[model samples]
Target chain A: MLSFYICLRKIPPMTEPRINPNVSVDCVIFSFEDDGLEVLLIERNAGQNRIEDDLLALPGNLIYEDETLDAAANRVLRELTGLKNIYLEQVYTFGDPARINKQKDQDWLHSIRAHPEARVITVAYTSLVKKSNFKISPSSFARQAMWVKVKEVPQLAFDHNALLEKALEYLKHKIYIEPLGYELLPERFTLAQLQKLYEAILDDHFDKRNFRRKVLRTSFIIPLNEKQKGVAHKPAGLYRFDKSKFHKI
Target chain B: MLSFYICLRKIPPMTEPRINPNVSVDCVIFSFEDDGLEVLLIERNAGQNRIEDDLLALPGNLIYEDETLDAAANRVLRELTGLKNIYLEQVYTFGDPARINKQKDQDWLHSIRAHPEARVITVAYTSLVKKSNFKISPSSFARQAMWVKVKEVPQLAFDHNALLEKALEYLKHKIYIEPLGYELLPERFTLAQLQKLYEAILDDHFDKRNFRRKVLRTSFIIPLNEKQKGVAHKPAGLYRFDKSKFHKI
Candidate 1:
């Protein structure tokens, strides 16, 4: 929207608190819903003066002089989408000098940044959240923040596509070793639902019997007495993640 | 030791290629030697006018404007310790606004850096090397680089002690899932030697029989037709890592 640019331009450069143009933080906030893995993205709407094409990107911004990288990531996510109190883990820092050298990205940067020529090295953070819990409200320069399916993510702004791939790889690897898969599921869940979550994240199909056998072997996934209440089919038993048990091992 | 300062001071600031003072790279290079897990550290000898106690820290320096983070890490490692062609993976980025806010660190920075007050966000890298393979010749401002046992590492410059701790945790976690331990061993090693390496890194004793049984279950460690020679103790059968088998899994 034109309002996004107008709002940014209204803030005089001299009056703004000094930001480290060379250092920024981008967050890949992922959620599992609609039978798939989805990532939060902000649509970069440059209005009428847009060059090349508009694109989507992770919620990100430069760190202020006094903020830590973690604080900056949380602040950026909150400022762009009004989402806060989410646990984010820093995954990687992409610091290629030519990361933002593409003409289209440079144009987008010029529209949004005061120092477009500064080499921005971004520290990327990834977090998983339940999609049903929070309402998406676009704020700051982001006019639209949406959860797009990971498989359907298009060509994003800057090096975001690459960042997304890295985040996905991290998520897939972490899901196997850590109890991170539970973040995307209900407090109590079925093995079928768990399989679907893994299939979405790993993009690989597993034999239902084998998947259950392997997962049940882990001490963290505790079987529960509860079952799916409203489903038409036979009710499957539920399971919950045993956080204390996981830590003990 | 004054030569270290003189060497740094010799580089005229104006003619120097612009460096990102706010971003740097540090390396935690680990090696298995002397019956313990060792880390490569450089002595920070701030000559005559030293305001604080001398410290040993990870090999690191600010990145140049044209380099990628990986390249900067390699450059920093090579420049500081005269070691090259080592594979380093980015583990974490330490970017607390107050990371280098300590008076001791500030004093040391004043003696070495052009912009000592810049909030440096260091991207830390970790690597494993065979201590017997390469000789370490301290270069740049580092007058003394040594392989100090991880257990004996002293208080470090900047936030390096915390960085080292994170790197150690990463190493401990990674050694379980990945074939990284091979990097710290010879081409052919005894099972006893392998167990010792694990004990040193994990800092826990494993029952000899159980450790052997667990490791032998893995397909990657191929039994070789070789054995230790000329030792006072009984000759132990040697085994080598199967790179192809490891990759296939």
Candidate 2:
């Protein structure tokens, strides 16, 4: 019952079982914005052509037979956002026997000229970067590239929902170990921004005093001489992260 | 120039570039033993007359066209150790182009009738198990299954040395968050044994008094009435981990 069938725009057809349609890469790109922590997803128009056509899916592509997994992830990211030097960390692998056997999935694959019964094993990856760092443009296979707040994600195409959950869990664990909250902030940000980043990712709140005290003890969160500007209320002092001092909280 | 090749005795030969040799799984099984912190490795006699013969490698196999990555890891672990229901955490993916193209690697894959130019992407996993809980037996692909001290590991086959390094680095980070050191100790162990386990994995010394005080503060470390018997020196008390309290280190 293990079968994998995948077809998307800009991706060359992987109809030949001999070409390893069994392997692919899925990305859960995370970025912080004014709304909150969001994930990048692509929309596909499901017309008479495919059953799952109109659903949203994570931007992904089959790993080329000659390329490494990291390369495949970078390619997909590059193709979708035109971003280079994107770093992807492995999160998990989704290889359920019927991952691609859903009726809608079958229809989509069949409509796209892929072997609908193919079993695909995909390596999922996670990337956290400042959303402003790159401009995103949808690739050919997708009708639109959208940044959806993690809390508001609807049912995704294929097994991307599960992939996204696992990536978020990994990121939650990672933030406490490494002072990576800075990646989600502006070049010079207020302490409140850093705390909010943690709250947004962990989905919880920390007492202001306790949070400030803990962050100050880390040494890496350096207070800048500058403060927030053009604000109606009292502005908070801005801070920057010193990469060299990154260690245990 | 970027071709990839890999070979192991118990592993089935994957020659057809059309068969999708692009995906694989590798397991790094860790357990505490009398010698120290050890990792399970399988010895492959590549051939009776081959340069790479007798090299040790982490137990691994290609992701089958029909199975999930977790199932594949479980199969490899079961084949070598006869244990089922083993849990594996995804570590990382090693997709460096040079992963399987070393001179010794080229010769071994060539000797084994495998296409030395095929690229393979392997998802790596790490599992920490209580050594005494399972019975280990070498499978057909491996001449012998051995548990060597992590520190004493020699140059391994494929890019396993790099794989091992990443697994170790991950475990080090996880230990600070999870009180998993107990998995490597005897059911009823003394404080000394616990301290030694931490020292072995972290590769650093801990002040005995501080270590004892810190461990005692954790609610999960339950003190038992049991103590070591018939030792030359004073026997210390035993303790066990309380799984229910394993949250928020």
Largest DockQ belongs to which candidate?
1
**Per-residue accuracy of model 1 over A1-249 as CA lDDT, tens digit each:** 899999989987875668998899999999998579899999765655655447788999899988889999999999899888999999999998998987787888888788999989999999999988778888877878999988899999889998999999888778767767667888988899888988888888999999999989988898998888988999999999887778522
How accurate locally, in lDDT, is each candidate? Answer: 0.88, 0.78
The best candidate in terms of lDDT: 1
Off by over 4 Å in 1: A1-15, A47-52, A209-230, A237-242, B1-15, B47-52, B213-219
Q: For candidate 2, write residues A87-174 as lDDT tens digits.
A: 8888877878688776666666666535556667788989888888878887656667878999999988888899999999999888
Two-chain complex of model 2, DockQ on C-alpha atoms against the true structure: 0.40
* Candidate 2 per-residue lDDT over residues B48-137, each given as its tens digit: 653544478898866666666788888877776566688888888777656878777667666653555677767889988887887778
DockQ of each: 0.76, 0.40
Model 2 steric clash pairs: A3-A118, A3-A119, A4-A118, A4-A119, A4-A120, A9-A141, A18-B18, A46-A53, A46-A54, B10-B141
What's each prediction's TM-score?
0.88, 0.84
Alpha carbon deviation, residue A14, candidate 2 (Å): 19
Which runs of model 2 end up more than 4 angstroms from their true locations?
A: A1-20, A45-53, A113-116, A244-249, B1-20, B46-53, B81-85, B110-117, B244-249
Q: Chain B TM per candidate, please?
A: 0.89, 0.85
